[model samples]
Target chain A: MEPNSLVKLNEARRERQAAILLSEIGKGRDRVIREGDTVAGPLGEAVAKAFRSGKSGMFELDGQEFFLNVQVPAPRIVVIGAVHISQALAPMAKIAGYDIEIIDPRTAFATPERFEGVALRADWPEEAMGDGYLDAYSALVAVTHDPKIDDYPLIQALKSNCFYVGALGSRKTHAKRVERLKEAGISDERIARISAPIGLDIGAASPQEIAVAVLADIIQAFRKRELSAAEQAKGAA
Target chain B: MSEQKLTEHLAGNGPAKDELQVAQDWMREGRNLAIATVVETWGSAPRPVGSHLVVDEEGNFEGSVSGGCVEGAVISEAAEVIESGEPRMLEFGVADETAWRVGLSCGGKIRVYVERLG
Candidate 1:
């Protein structure tokens, strides 16, 4: 690995961009490839697969061996509510290797006692999530169910192209939310990406069960996220 | 875990330093450095592929290629690689002749690539 390549790879990781360090087995030459950069032929296919799977391994192409060291930023959750559902979801997200940050302006609900070991922000979402705080690798879950609290981040998540954007609400509430988002000038196509009635349709009743459903839904969305950034829709990974 | 340990974990003080970052910093400081990366692993290898163990000329290391197993040998080899500017591939497993000496206790196999960073 060249010192310059190492610097570039670390820069990409710190910036939360996906990259792979491709090193030839015996030649001892390596280069860094960003998520969208194009490489030709069989090696390109292996590179794309490595980016998608977030796995690093040795690949042998036509007897030439290369090692792909994949660096996919760890996916995290940005929940807009510190309510019961988020309280339930926090630990589960941590266990799944996804760190979570809870942002809610409601102090009583966002109390530290309710969110142990969780990154809690008792500020409005607009203030809490500054520019570039949300990205394609994060799953934005807005469960506040309050228009004032939930609307801004949902719009921002769509604009930021979050991989998964979900909201906790019933069909009736989602209908109203949809109208509000449309009025806010978000495209119908963009508004359509919000996974309202948030979570997998697992017949969840309790807050904990709802958390489980949401985690499952986000996991599926992440693993199946689009490979080409040019083709992904709003809120698609 | 103890209360202090749990609080430390919860408070999210990040680990000391990233292995790659350490390698870069050492390079900038004019220290001789070699990096050992787990290029491939099979069975229950402790660390996954792409994991790095950066070693300085003095055998000082900041990361693990086998979760503390087989690191001594890797660091020793790193000195020679730093001297020659040539890369070497090392294989460790329970089936190897060095099993009792430097093999992975986890009953797994791993191929490590060691090279100097310029």
Candidate 2:
């Protein structure tokens, strides 16, 4: 590659990286870095790999070497209730590299002492979710088991691009909850996105175990969505 | 590129962006430099592929292709690449005796491609 072109390429890459990072979009586009040739392309495979794995790497396509540098936003977990399960879930999620926010109107339960080191919001779900708090990178878990607390957030999650939406309840409870959502004008397709009974059915009997199950389910949903998005981008390319 | 364009690019995020800015700065100051990128890895390599290490003519460097395991060798080779203006592909693995000498105790393999940056 010519010195001038190399400079141009690097500048373009930096611009794209900045845009993705500032937006917390976790997306990047880079071309094959090669010697003597101006080998540039969409870098579809690299983009997809970076998006799915959240790890960047270099790979050869058709014998040409390409470097994929990805910057993924920190994944976030928004728990709708500051209950016992949330107490377990918050710390565990933090250990797994997720920024957690606990929301509950009940100030007693949402105290800083109960949920140390985690962001606590003693406000209604709708109020807490106002602007930049919720996005595609966020996972919403409604563990309050209260329709007033969990339902509104679940509806908001469905309306937005939240990757995962889970609500803690029994099968019977979820059925009734679904009927209530229908009455609230939430479409059946959108309501279906909620993972009712909240977590992976690991037969969890304690708050800690349930938190584990919920975290596992959230990760599963996140990975699956990333894979699908990568596939879609590849198809479009 | 213009100074304004360069500044705009540096305003972006990520470790790679920072590395690129450093490279550009060193180049502007007339210092010869080379970049070594992790092109591939096998088994339990510490750093992911696309990880980078930039080396200047005086052996000053930043970033990592194999964490602390094989960076010493990469930096050494990178300095040579800067002087020679030649590119080379380097590979290190547990099965190789050099791997043990370089502290690749994690029993993984990594391939790094070294090249001069304009």
RMSD of each: 4.2, 9.2
Residues A135-199 of candidate 2 have per-residue lDDT tens digits of: 66789999988998888888788777667899999999999999999999888877898998889
lDDT of 1 by residue, A2-107 (tens): 9998999999988998999999877779999988778888898899899888999999987878999999999999999999999889999999889899999999
Model 2: residue B87 alpha-carbon error in angstroms = 4.9
Could you tell me which residue pairs clash in candidate 2?
A57-B49
Mark the 10 consecutive residues where model 2 chain A has the least summed lDDT: A18-27
Off by over 4 Å in 1: A232-237, B1-14, B94-104
Best by lDDT, which number?
Answer: 1
Per-model lDDT = 0.86, 0.70
* CA deviation > 4 Å runs, candidate 2: A1-50, A57-61, A65-67, A95-97, A171-185, A226-237, B1-34, B42-46, B55-60, B67-73, B76-87, B93-108, B115-118
Measured against the true structure, the TM-scores of the candidates, in listed sequence, are 0.90, 0.66
On the 0 to 100 scale, the lDDT of residue B107 in model 2 is 73
CAPRI verdict (incorrect, acceptable, medium, high) for model 1:
medium
Give every collision pair in model 1.
Answer: none
